[model samples]
Target: MSDALGYASPQHYPAVVTDRWGRVETTLVNDGTAFGMILRGNRFEGKSVDGLALVGPPVGSNPPTLCDGDLCSCTIEWRMPIEVSLDGAGPSRVSLSAHLVLGDPTPNRGIDSVGVTLTLHLPTGVVATTTPQELIENALLDLQRLLPDGTRLLACISCAFSDYSPAGTAFIGSMACFRDRKDAYRAVSGKRDMYDIWSAMSGVVQETYHCPDFARRRPGSGYRG
Candidate 1:
C-alpha cells in the first residue's frame, strides 16, 4: 500500500481484491493506499475479503454490483508465496496461482460443483523432481483429472496434493449456502478463537473446501519424516 507501490490516492482509486477462491474484485478503496492494504490483508474479516486479486474497478466508482452469473462465471486470478516440501528432501519456494470460478455450472442439489485451473511455477530445478508426479497420484476420492501439464494440473471438481507433500488439501467451491458473503463476515468477526479458525482450516480436508485446489498438512495426518 505504499505510494512507492504505484497506487493512486484512496478517494480516487479502486483496489483490486482476490478471494480465497481466487476470484478477483475491484472496489473503491475508502481511505487510501494504507487503508486498502488493511482491507486486503484482513480478508478473513469477511466475505468481501477472502483474499485480493490484481483486478479492480474504475477509480471513484463504488464497488461493482456482481450478478449471480458474474459470480458464477468469473474466473479469479491469485498469486501466493508457497513453500513446497517434498517428502523429506526440503522445502522449496514456489509461486502459486489458482484460477477459480465461483459457483456450480451444473448445480447438483446437495453437491457443489466447481471448475478449477491451476498454474504452479516451481523453482528453476524443482520441476525435475518427482514431487509433481506424486501430487497427482494420491488424490481425493472424488477428484477427477481433466488435464495435466508437467508441473501444472487441472481437475473438474478438485485435486489432491497429498502424495507429494504428504499433506492434505482443501477444496472450496462457490455454492449458495457456502458462498454467502455474510457468512464469511460472521466467521472472521465471530467470537471463535483465532487458533480454532486456523485449526478448522488446517485440519484434514473437510467438505467445506470446494473451489480452486490448495495443499496443506492435515492435523494428525502423520509426519513426512
Candidate 2:
C-alpha cells in the first residue's frame, strides 16, 4: 500500500540533524528491510547542548524503548548539569540556537536541519541587566561542559517553536525529521512535529519481541541437522 502519490511501498528514508554552523551532525537511515546508522558522537553531544537538558536520565538500566514492526525506533536520553547565576548582574534572558537533519540512501540522500532557539528568562535582578555576549558565553560554556566532543551541523531549514511554555511563553525544544525507510525512492521525507519517531521505532520492536513467534525462537538456533 502507498500514499496518494502512487509510490509503491514507502521509500526507505534517512534522518539528518544539523548544527547552527550548517554541518551534518547526525544521520539516521531507514532501509526497507532494516534500519540502522552510525550517529556522530559530536552530533549527539550537540543535542544535549540544546534545550534537551530538561529530560534528565532514564528511569532504569533499560532506557525507554520503541518499535514499529519492520521499522526501527530508538531513543537517546541524557542530561547536562547547569548552574543558574542570578546575582543581580546579568541580562534578563538568554537565547541559543540548534538544528536537526534527516537523511536517506535508496531514494536519495537529502538533508534537513532546522534552527532551534532556546530562551532562558532570568529573574528580575539579572533578567533586565545581563549582556547578550555574556549570557551567550555562559550558556555556551555550560553547553561545552555538557557536550565536550562537539556536534555536527546538517542542512539548513527554517526557524521552529519550542515546547517549554511557562508563563504563556515557549522555551527550547527540537524539530524532528521523519523518514519511512521502506521505499528507496523517497527516503528523506520532511516533518514539522516533535513526535520523536526514534522512540516510536523502538517501541515497535519491543511489541514484536513479545509476540509468541518471536518468543519461541531460540537464540543462535539456525542449523539444518
Candidate 3:
C-alpha cells in the first residue's frame, strides 16, 4: 500500500484484530499520513494473510492434506455460518469451516490423531457490535417495556434468588435459581451451603434469558450484573 501511494518511509503503525481466544483475526494497516488520506491511510488487506485458504492454508504450521488419490482415503468438511445483530442494525455474518482428513492405510504406521487449526474471517468494516453487558441491559429494558405496566424483566442476573458460583461465570453466567429452596440457597448460589441441593433443576442460567420462576433483586445487592 505504501508503494501504491508513493511513500518513501512509512511511520504509521499497524493495529491487529483478534478473537476472544487471542488468535489472529485481521489487521488495520496505515500506509500514509492523515492529511493525504481519509484521516488515516488504512488498508484492509487479506490477500497476504496467513491461513486464509478455504481448503488448506499453506501458512499453517502443519499444512493439512485435503486429499491424495493414491495416498489418502477419506475426507470430510464442515461449515457453519452465523449472523449477529445488535441494536437493531444490519447484521454481520461470520462463517467457520473445518476439514477432517484421514490418510490412506500406510505400511509402516497406523492412523494417528492430528491437531486442529482454525482461521476466522471478519468483515472489513464491522457494522454493529456491543459488549455482552450492554446487550444484556438493553435487552432487559426492551423486554420490560413490552411487559405490563407493573412488571419488570426479571432473570437470573436481576433475581435475588440467584448468585455466582465458586469458580465465577462460564461465559453466559454462573448464577443458579434458588427460588425452589430460597431459604437454604439464597445467600450464595451453587457453591457453599446449597452445594448438594443445586442440581440441573436449579442450574446456571443466562444473564439475560427470561424464565417463569421470577424474583426481583434488591437495590444495592451488588449482584446487578
Candidate 4:
C-alpha cells in the first residue's frame, strides 16, 4: 500500500467569547482526539520534519552512476513548502520553499560518501550544504580503532562479519565466482599466509570457518580444523 498523505486530518480549536462589559467567558466543547502529527519528509539523523515533499525516491536507493574521486553523485531530491517546523521552534519554521538534494554512493572500490544540499527559494536565500567527509573519516578512524589488536583484515563483501569468518585459503579459480583464471591466479597464487590472502580478497570470498572458543584439543589433533 502507498503511504498516506500528511495533513489529511483536521484540528479543532475552542471558542472564547468576550461580553460588552469586558468580561471574558469560555465555552467548553468536547473536541475529538488530537490530530496525529504527520511528518511528511524523511528523517535524516533522526530529526522529525513536516511539510517535506520528496521530488525523487525517498532516500538511499543507489542509482547506477559513477562518482568522481570521493564525492557522491546526486540521486534524490526534495521539495518542501514554507512553515515547516524543524525542531519545534518559531525560527525553525522555513521562511521560503526550499529544495534539498541528497546523494549516497555504495563504496565498491573506495571510501563511501554522503552529500546534501539545501537551496532556499527566497531572494537572499542562504545555501547550506555539506558532505561532512571529515566527520565520516573521524568515525571510520574510531571504527578501525575498535577492532582487536590482532584483527586480520578480511574483505568478504557478500557476507557480514558476524555471519562468516576466514575458513581456509581459496585459490580464486576454484571458487565458482571467478570468471577469468588469470585474475584468480594473480589474486591467490602468491598468498603464502592466511592473513595476507584474507586481507586482499575479503570482498570476493565467503569462507565460513568454525570458531569454537575454549575447546580442549582432541588426542593427536594437528591444530583445530
Candidate 5:
C-alpha cells in the first residue's frame, strides 16, 4: 500500500536518533536542532542520481603528491528528471535538469575514463509503488558494495564540520569543509565571511570533490543526512 503524505511523512525534517538498543531519544524529528526545516520539491526528484568519475593513483617524481600537476583524480555527472508513475499507470517522463560540467579532460587520450554506471532507486512495495526511494537507495548501496575496497562516498555534504552558508552557496548549495577534515568546526559565526576564514585555518578543500580526509557528519548535529 502507498504511504500517505502527512505532516510527519516527508524526510525533510531532522530525523530521529536511537540508542544502541534502539531506544528512542527524542519524540520529535526536530529535537536538538537549531531550527526546524521543511523540504521542498523533493518528491519530484529522480529516485536516483547517476554519476561518473575518473580515478587514478599517482606514481610521479615525488611520492607525497596527491592529484597534483595532473588531471583531477575524479569527475562526476548526474543526469535527471527521470520520472516514473507513482501508481504505475502513466507514461514515464524525464524531469527538468541543468547543464553542468566538472573538469577538463586529460590531454592524453588512449586511457581516458569511460566506464559507465546507473543509479536509481527501485520500487519497494509488493503490490504498489510510491515514488522510488526504496528502489534508488538499494541500487546505490549495491553499487558501493561492488566498488574496490576503501572506496567511499565521503564528501563535505555528509561531514559534520560542514554546513550550508547562510549568505549564499553554489547553485546546488554552498557548504564549507576545512581541508584538514576536523572532528568539529573550528568556529561557528554569524558574519558572512567567518566561515571562509575559519576554513582557511586548515585549508579549503575543493567543494564537492573527493577529499583526502573525510569524516561522517556527527549524529544529531542538526543535519538531515
Candidate 6:
C-alpha cells in the first residue's frame, strides 16, 4: 500500500524485493563499496517465508507494514561490506557479502549472506595494450578453464565505444554475447571490430585478455595458446 520504497519486483540492475502487498524495495548492495539499507513498515512482523525478516522501530500503532493485514510491521536493515580492487586497467570483478539484522527489540531474523557481483569500469591508464594475436591467445587460455571439453572458438565481433570518461583516458565499449563463458572467451580471442577500429579492437582485446585461467599445468609448463 505504501509506495515509499516503490513497487517490488525482481528486475535487472539493482536487486529489488517486493512483498505480496505491492510494497517494493530496491537494493544495490553488490557494489564494491560499503552500503546499507533500512525499510520501516507495519507489515514486517517476523521473517518472511523466504528467510527474509522485517526490522522494527518499536512502540507504535504504525509498525512496519508489509501489506494490508493487521500485523505489526518491523524495521529491517542490512549492511553490506564491499571490497573492490583492479587487476588491471580493463575490467575488474567484485565480491560482496553482508550481515542482515531484522527487528530491534528481539533481533529476530539475522544472517550473513553473499550478494551478487558488481563489475566496475576502470580507467584506461590502468590497462595495458596488446596486439590482436596476444588478445586471442589470452582469451584461449581463459576459455580453456571456463568452457567444457569440445567447445570451439567462434568469431568475435567487436563493438564500438558508446561512452568515454571525462578524462578521455578510458572508454566504455560493448561486445556481442558468447554462448557461454567459454564461448565468450573464444570470441574475445579473435579480432573483428563491430563499429569502429578503436572500440572493436579494445573490446576484443580486453575480453580475451581479462578471463581467469583455470587449467592444470605441469611443472615448468607454459600456457598453451
Q: Which candidate number has the best TM-score? A: 1
Residue pairs clashing in model 5 are 81-95, 120-136, 121-135, 121-136, 122-135, 122-136
TM-score of each: 0.31, 0.17, 0.31, 0.20, 0.28, 0.20
List per-prediction Cα lDDT, in the order shown.
0.30, 0.22, 0.36, 0.25, 0.31, 0.25
lDDT of 6 by residue, 1-225 (tens): 112111232212233333223344545321111122333332222212112334443334433433322122222222222122333123233322211222222234332221121121223222122221112223333433333333222212111111112222211112222222332233332223212223222221111112222222232221111
Which ranking of candidates, highest lDDT first? 3, 5, 1, 6, 4, 2
Residues 50-95 of candidate 3: C-alpha lDDT, one tens digit per residue: 1112222233343222222121233323333333233333444454
TM-score of predicted model 5? 0.28
**What is candidate 2's lDDT per residue for 146-225, written digit by digit as tens?**
32132211110110111111122111212111123212212212232123223322111100001111111122211100
lDDT of 4 by residue, 155-216 (tens): 11111221112353221111111212223323342224323434333223112111111122
lDDT, candidate 6, at 21: 37
The digit string of per-residue lDDT tens for model 1 on 70-189 reads 232234444433344333344455554444444433444221333444444655432222112112122222122221232222221122322112233323311111111223322442
* lDDT, residue 100, candidate 6: 22
Instruction: List candidate 1 stretches off by more than 4 Å.
Output: 1-72, 86-88, 103-113, 125-225
State the lDDT of candidate 5 residue by residue for 50-144, as single tens digits. Answer: 11111234333322111223222222223332333333244343221111222334545322332323343324321212222222223333443
lDDT, model 3, position 25: 26
Q: Which candidate's lDDT is highest?
A: 3
Extract clashing residue pairs from model 3: none
Flag the better candidate by lDDT, 3 or 5. Answer: 3
Stretches > 4 Å off in candidate 5: 1-152, 181-207, 220-225
Model 6: lDDT to the true structure = 0.25
Global local distance difference test of model 5: 0.31
Candidate 2's C-alpha runs over 4 A off are: 1-81, 88-110, 125-225
